[model samples]
Target: MNSISYFLQPDSILFNSQDIDFKMPFGATACGEEITFNILTEVSINCLDVRLILKNGKESEFKLYKKKEKKIRDRDYIVWSLHFKTPSLPKTLFYHFKFLIGNSNSIFYYGNNSLGLGGVGSIYENHPIDYQITLFYKNNPSPKWFKESIAYQIFPDRFCNANRDGKLNATKENSFIYGRWNDKPMYIKNSKGEIVRWDFFGGNLKGITQNIGYLKDLNVGTLYLNPIFEATSNHRYDTTNYHNIDPILGTLKDFKEMVRECKQRGICTILDGVFNHTGKDSIYFKDASRSTKSPFYSWYRFKEYPYDYDSWWGIKDLPCVNELEPSFFKYIVEGENSVVNHWMKTGIKGWRLDVADELPSFFIENFRYKCKKIDSDAIIIGEVWEDASNKISYGQRREYFNGKQLDSVMNYPLRTYLLNFYNGSIDSETLLKYMNSLRENYPAENYFSNYNLLSSHDVKRIKTSVKDIVKCFNIDTQLQGAAVTRVLKSLSLIQFTLPGVPVIYYGDEVGLEGGKDPDNRRTYPWGSEDSNLLKWYQKITSLRYNSKILKKGEVKFFSPHPDVFGYIRYLPNTNDFIGVISNRSPYKSKFFKLNLKELVGQFSNNITTDIYLWNESLIVPIDSSTDFPIKIPPLKTLLFSSKSV
Candidate 1:
């Protein structure tokens, strides 16, 4: 800790990529785009020279000239800078600053902090952990509508049922339908931990069709439905056939009707593309298992053939696909009526690829090409659970954002940090650091297009995850609901305001509570929703809808207290500064005077201001000074702006 003064501090304003003075063209750079890098260091180090250590494949070095000298807090400092253009292709480049100490002629380096949280880096003697610069293709731009849209994710089997007589749709022989719509989702497994009988609540595509108006009223412009392709399980991640809708859901015609209904109401559809694997019960797999010469035999890898085959994570129910196998590749990507082409022609807006990390880059690139060829506006969002820009999978750094593979990725990093902050696993300040690193790593297009979800079918519902993170059932029912509601409100505020398309899992708006897997996929309690929570969701959604600040404004993060996370969204051309602050402590209330002048610098003293609390919006006076005292109760968040918002 005592040696902190020697570091380059990549996360601070002195080296922050988000700041124009430090890194020109900011966040993600385009191919062949000129980028400027700057670093500030104390002039007392007796530094003789500073060089940039850049690495894409083989490492290279570039010289940095001393740009200026300045006095900060009466201490002398030096600003060193260099300019370089990206290569002809997109690549993720890493860089660090190495200095030659004058008198000693010894080499010292400065780079990213140990944990890579970005802010306030450390000085290194050798082998510095570098900062990332993602270069993306200039031509890959996602649809304008998608980047600006608000999304809703529906786990088909649990969202709704449109049967007039309450009869199940094409009931399968080995599946059971819940007699009641409110029953919690439960897996019917055998002693071997294998699902013996898939269960369903009979939610169909017709259900979504019937509810299109409801989704429209919720201010949802995009509907990201979980796997709708024919799969045996309720989750539908295991695909039996790519061309047909799961019978348990509905017929192909029903799917078309749903898409049509949604389009009529101005909603886009994104279907989950689960190409990494197929169901063991699928006829293709069954036939391949029975015969060595089956046409689909080479589509999968077999350890011994017959009954032994490679499965996804050793889950025998799902047979892993050999994505690069010629036959499989042709069928999925190059076929006349290929899987991607089939759906794209049907008017669906795009695909949300399942387990995107498992699929080969070539396969994804082909998928993207096919989709774009059919409908140029189609968006391709991959399910990459971490930082997508520089993610290393299978010992290879992924080029997802290089502009050929995916339009964007699932923003699991944001979800992870936000949940950790609210759950008390991490403080607000730490969360902000992680978030800043994310924003700095990704290109603006991908960041804005990323699907931001609080809850999804794969994880616990937001309500349950926040309050019952341990998965303990000991908490009283009423107490859990209130606690969940309190945390969710603050979380929703952050989710909607961040620079991405905020997705609401089907029942999350109404306070659905469940933990993991089958538990998390609980049926939406249509009649039992908490009205207040529903209204709260609506309020946040409407606020985001009406404000351009949330959609395109630049973000500046701050933490007035360790337990509170806040940010101001502002457009450079406007005087408006939209403020959002959250107090994540369970019992500790926050009281502090927020100095707008200190944060954003020199705002008009008498700026018309409105502070919006969860229950109400009130006028807050800011006279003669750019500071105002903000007192937030425990488990709450507030929005402030120059407008009555």
Candidate 2:
């Protein structure tokens, strides 16, 4: 008797298409849609069974039909295909292949892991390793323009200054102005050890309008301002008035001109919507606090008459609003004179909801409805910190990506993964797995439109984060500088190459460094800018703007070693392809061999190829017949583009 050997390769699995044998579309499908899945084997198999595992833990057998027998690279193989209709309703489904080899007593199972690739393992090993696909409501689509734009996040008070008067705005009653533009932000306290007041840098809307050409030079398509509305604080998360621009920042006329100038230069503006809470000094809250009979009184949840009220995270100054209150809802989104409608009437293109998880689904739905009613193309982004697709908040699952609530959420999970990978805490394989999980969880449209960022006003600057990691070990100063620069460049390379709308924090391109909150909000150093870093940013942004493959092409990842991560972004319909690889190890240079036979075969012999490292061109050959080995500096990145002329 001969023994039967069984094998399965999950990476070679294909779903819904016959031409591309390795393409697998996971997560979010429509009901009644005809879906096809295919699996390839090393040899001919007679006794193989595949099943669709439902969310209810029931395994339903799928009819596997042998599609064809073919020879690839001098190896014989068999292709198995399964076609089934997607089940009704919204639920997650997992599937795997079960093999029972010709009366053998043993059963071999193949399933997907964190990387979304195949491995021979148990069916019930550690909570369903099988491939997962989520079914969502059909006809849900995100905005078209948002998915292809390069987003630039500006902290309005620190981005730029057009007046150049070397003074700050002191119009607010209790506010203090800085004497010099390069002065460090002061967090001064009174004798009682309490923060008495805040200072301003006076970067206004006119400044932004004056610098529109700079953004255009960087090819920034979308400008995401932190908050420009009337507020006591510089950051403006606590809003005093939604309808008016902050006096210190600018007036309505200035804002209008800024928006008009940005529009003329092909840049859309995204305003930060702070609807979850209001400043204690705001008119609505002040009126309610003054008298119980006030019309705004019902807009708050008060345990007592005046002082006792529900605040956001126990912050007394920021009172949480009753979003479902008819009066409040009407004021914000429902009525003809609503804040959202009023702002959309301006030239602003979209809104990024502040603390969206705190806002109820109905409020978000109404907001989206009203915005779309006014302008169907207006995009609404949410500040969701986790996986927005299936995030559970307040004991309820959020439908942020189901096409009704948020067009996209900030991609913080990707930021964490990238930072950890570059900081030497995680390997390339782990990074790939986490990235693949995010890719599988999100809907395709939302995935592309995700606000991917490396640093923001809420977090420590990217340069500071990298420098801190290096300083923790007490390394040489020169080595530390080199390592930090390389790591930052490498991370930026990945940020620009990855799928999503890459967001550049205000001063990050100029190599700004700061810790948290007040520190991260440092004034942009105009005269002391790092020329090398700025030039590097210009080159990378140029590459992103010029390459269609980096913007919209499908991504395929390959990691030849644990320390090296690489991916190829290629458009199947077009002949454009981009290869990006990174070396995350700080102590050693790595020679990475990329398997580009299939990619190179797609191009003709006369194709142009160029390799670059931080704007410096490197010498590397473009060959189709053999695998290429490229040496990368420690903690550096190398980008190869077929379209680079």
Highest-TM-score candidate: 1
lDDT of 1 by residue, 1-645 (tens): 234343334322246555676778767789998988888877666678889889989899999999999776777778898989888878898888888866456777877777775655667768777888888888788888898889999989888889898778887777888888888778888898878888888888888898888787688999999998888788888888888888878898998988988898889999998889999878789889989899999988898867788999999889998999988888788888778778888899999988899999999998899888888999999999999998888998999999899888888788899888876778877888888888888888888887898888878888877776523424556666565677788888889988889999998998888898889889889889989888878888888888888888778888877899998887775677688888876667888888767665543333444433333345554442456677788778877776666
Name the TM-score of candidate 2. Answer: 0.86
The C-alpha stretches of model 2 lying farther than 4 A from their native spots are 1-27, 37-51, 56-82, 87-122, 125-131, 137-140, 189-194, 472-475, 598-615, 618-621
TM-score for each of the candidates: 0.94, 0.86
Instruction: List the RMSD of every prediction in angstroms.
Output: 3.0, 4.7
Query: Each candidate's lDDT (Cα)?
Result: 0.82, 0.76
Clashes of each: 2, 1
